[model samples]
Target: MGLITEARTEKLMQNFSAIDFRMSIEDFSVRVLNTLTGVIPEFNKGRVMIKSEDKIYRCAAWKGFSDDIRNFQISEDEDPISADDTPKIYRNIYNIYRKALHGSMEDIMIKSGLPEVKVSVVVGIFFEGKIVGKVFLESAMDIDISKYDLYLLKFVSKVSSLFIGMKFFQERERRYHKDIIMAMVKALEARDTYTVGHSERVALYSVHIAKELGLDIKDVDKIYWGSIVHDIGKLSIPEHILMKPSKLSPVEYELVKNHPVAGEAMIKDFPWLDRIRPIVRNHHERWDGKGYPDGLKGEQIPFEVRIVTIADAFDAMTSDRVYRKSYSLEHALSEIIRLSGKQFDPEIAKVAVDVLNRVFPVIRNS
Candidate 1:
């Protein structure tokens, strides 16, 4: 029994690993149900039903059942009993299982039609310590319940609960991080009202160019973050210089150039921002090493930075600035293309052109 328990635990761990590696929920559910059925052949025709957000129990996966039962749906308040007042085996199992939650000791076999079956189990699924759902299992033949079997059920139940809890917390953490990043971007935008929608436009353009260039998922995520905080350093610059109506003098222009450095410094304490530092610092660097505080040449700047540079420029050219009118989409595209190899990475420039062409039909001039 110890060996059997160990083997089952190992298999369950493997399934959990597959789930943790980002398998689709459907696939994970199927694997879990299969695992459960494999351990107890009497459950060969068992099904796993998930309680959805709408309070509907939907048949997520099953091993065996007629087509009619396989696709069955039940509302939360609806009982599984028949109109004739006869409880089906599944309904009896659910009723008995529900009673277990309250520590009721009424024999399940007394209610179930399968009186010959001697062993029964009720397991709860929990997410964050709250019982969200349950699983029911019964023996097909007379059999004495063993300690090992009970332990196995407990282990499987605990695993399911932990997975659900982890997933819940993971989603919450993702939303929290997203909110923080958005709030930071908003704060930056609020400080410089002239560029209200700048980060969003840059993010959109960066993603488009990333897709056109066939960038990997990691690279795309990096570009997205970079575009959002490209001008974050402007938070450190004086409002008068940032919102100046006329062209910047040499001194003021130099102060503006230092923004990238300032932005980098602002986020340096965050380890996650390390991936985006290059994009923030080098978005203004010219392809020929003619732009910015650090004149990084072609192929010397990070590829992600190069991709964002074109996106940043395209958005800026087509956006209304305090000093000048925005250019038309066609004019912006032409200007970008003309600067390719000199002011922008030629490959990235071409990709940006294709992205703008396909996505924004009306590239309106400001």
Candidate 2:
């Protein structure tokens, strides 16, 4: 059957133009496959798989995979297969992931003695001319792929490689920043023994709340970055007040409140962090207009910032401090509930309580 109709070609071009640059690798993989399968009749069902470090991630799939195929997962250590080995499978083995992945996916159906085609058409996704991934079109009968089809796939794969490679580098940069942020948080927290793991715990709590509130990925990510750095401004505070074993003097208290402003200033120049600044700066702001920095009240706080505030307060109440033992979960929840509309956004606080109880099963059981 002639697969690439003239109209199909135009539509494929249109679909190719729809690829989103800012998505995560897995998301991009799924979107790419969806677009391809949506427009191309020959590409009835296929998927993209990438081997990263220790795992083979079946990042995306469109129809045609059985339950076994849909459930396939493989570890790099088990097969000792390299990206260099992949083409050989397509070229010679025909079912490498099936063998390597323990009969998890396509190979299972193939091995079940299901009737199949002798040939598969695939395009290698390359970065700097080495295959990092692949695009595939599955068929039940041998495919007499045309020159136009090959060229279209090659063009699509080439364009997609740039996007995938961009996502790869973008993820690498995010990891680098994660390490730097964690180190900075560690150093800042090290100044007070009681504050160890504070940022991480707050981040965890904040993420749970963000998810429970049904926030989008970008907003959730912003919450994570903001929560982890909420105390980054404390790096500028003098250790004497930060490590004070007793209640702070009025002057010391005022200085401590300055950390949010200082932290906001420290990160304002980081373009990647521009979206995260509001959460870091206004996390201390109150719902009823009684909070810090600008004392902006109620819905005036960014919704993202409001979420972090509740998470921050919950963690702060639960974690041990130099001057006081951690509050019991029950007590902390009560205190938070009491202050919901006043100290935290009532809606966010309510959802945060549910997330803590449900997501942390220990809290639920206790």
Candidate 3:
């Protein structure tokens, strides 16, 4: 009997077509390829390739070809469909193309050390009237597959295409969110180019400190993101105050100090981002209870917030300002150690310096 009976194909199709938003594109592709090689006994190897707008074929998944199948991109490759099948396949945008490959599918069998056969069972995936991808399966037992078996392979191809389409939509949504965030960042930088890259540097510095202190993955991620947008509240301050080249008066300094509270308020509606709110609000707080806003001190300040506090200070000291030159690396590091338990948390301050030495060894210049 040929592999992939009608009943089995129906069951597989139902499961594969089910949309899963939790799965990332890479994870979804891997899951599809793994399931293919598992149930279809005759298919000793399998792969899915999709076309991009640039007229090139990109590998989305490949089992028995490489450990990481997402690496390769093939160019100058022809469609796996035959001239006779093209008319039929293109007749319906949802329909798939099937054929026996004597040439094209050899790319995998050759690399995977399978026998170079005259042809392998191949299925071309079609999504919305485009030849977006194709999946190839090589037989292991040298059994001749029945016509129905090929039909089942075509059905599986459609399931793979469904997952890929979902992946594309998910990515588009994320890019939209990212574009909005970046626009805000750009607006802030426009007012004060001196701090153009300050947020990103603080993020990198905090990530290093998180690693040095052995914080778990979740805490590390929150700290990194919070550091990147720590100064977001500064956007609420007047542009003239932010752009001031001279020392701020007491009234101007008070307004500048309200940024941490404003930053927290901006993201208060997002529960998923709650972990970061503390980090942002308390980023300016001191270890001695002398800081503004809430005056959180010692361990009372969120651990991640303390990490960012030290990182923010370091970047500010090392970075150039319109009113003054940056401090030397030696002077900045010395000042941090001297101010431990005064301006910054003593424990986090030590770890911050160690992280600096480990991550950036070039100490000749700040």
Reference-based lDDT, each prediction: 0.69, 0.72, 0.69
Model with the higher TM-score, candidate 1 or 2: 2
In terms of TM-score, which candidate is strongest? 2
Encode model 1's per-residue lDDT on 54-131: one tens digit a residue: 876555554444344344555556523221111123333435334433423233323333333334455666775555
Full candidate order by lDDT, most accurate first: 2, 3, 1
Q: How does model 3 fare in lDDT?
A: 0.69
Candidate 1 ranges beyond 4 A from true positions: 1-6, 14-126, 129-157, 361-366
Query: Across residues 224-320, which tens digit of lDDT does each residue of candidate 2 receive?
Result: 8898999999999898888888888999999899999999999888888888888878878999998899999988899988988887888788888
* Clash pairs (backbone) in predicted model 3: none
Q: TM-scores across all candidates?
A: 0.65, 0.84, 0.67
Instruction: Estimate the overall C-alpha local distance difference test score of candidate 1.
Output: 0.69
Candidate 2: which stretches are off by over 4 Å? Answer: 3-10, 38-40, 64-70, 76-119, 128-130, 360-366
Model 3 spans > 4 angstroms off: 1-7, 10-14, 49-60, 66-71, 76-134, 139-143, 203-228, 245-247, 268-279, 285-311, 328-366
Candidate 3 lDDT, 245-338, residue by residue in tens = 9899999999899998998888787665677888878889899989978987788888888889998899888878878788877788888999
Clashes per model (N, Cα, C within 3 A): 0, 3, 0
- Winning model by lDDT: 2
